[model samples]
Target: MNTDVDQDDCWICYRCHKKLELKQVSVLYLGGRFEVELMQCPQCKMVIINEDLALGKMLEVEKGLEDK
Candidate 1:
């Protein structure tokens, strides 16, 4: 994992307000039509979707919903 802190990419915990580190967290997307990456806060251990991945997943979800 990259240790560099990207202020734009990293998110802080709402409760603790600590910077989320990439190196200390793991992302897992399971049982979805398309694979997705998740960002997790190291301090508070909160999981969030990164912007680009979220958009891609949104597209996939939209397609799935439309097909249904």
Candidate 2:
């Protein structure tokens, strides 16, 4: 996925109030772990899990993994 951040879509870390940068983030679901480029705070390592993702790809992956 092209996680290249668009300035309009930029996110700030809730805890740090810092701009989140694109980095490889570890995601876990159903005992499975994988890395995907995501926006997160460099200082706190906090990741963004937006609504589109929660109801979209992430949900799809979770269901697919659970069916395994």
Candidate 3:
């Protein structure tokens, strides 16, 4: 849930071409609110959800909520 954006990462925003920074983002899912640090664009406010998060913890939490 927490990660640092290293200078070597060099992740550029597709839309703004600005560098991605590590920021705290609020995620609301299944009536639950969670705060996670992720790579985000400062100009456009776009958040990048990586593959590990999308198919890993996030997916697991989503499935668990749907089954309840």
Q: Best-fitting candidate, measured by TM-score?
A: 3
Show pairs that collide, candidate 2: none
Per-residue lDDT over 1-68 for candidate 2, one digit per residue giving the tens place of the 0 to 100 score: 53444546768888998988888788886677867777889899988766676677778888897788
Q: Which portions of model 2 show Cα errors greater than 4 Å?
A: 2-8
Model 3 scores what on Cα lDDT? 0.82
Query: What are the TM-scores, per candidate, against the unseen true structure?
Result: 0.44, 0.73, 0.81
**Could you give candidate 3's per-residue lDDT for residues 1-68 as a string of tens digits?**
76443546889999999998888899886688889888989999898887777778788889999898
lDDT of each: 0.55, 0.76, 0.82
lDDT of 1: 0.55
lDDT (C-alpha) at residue 57 in model 3: 74
Q: Over the stretch 1-68, how does candidate 1's per-residue lDDT look in tens digits?
A: 23233547757778778776544444443434433234566666786655655556565666776787
lDDT of 2: 0.76
Record all residue pairs in model 3 with backbone atoms less than 3 Å apart, i.e. clashing.
Answer: none
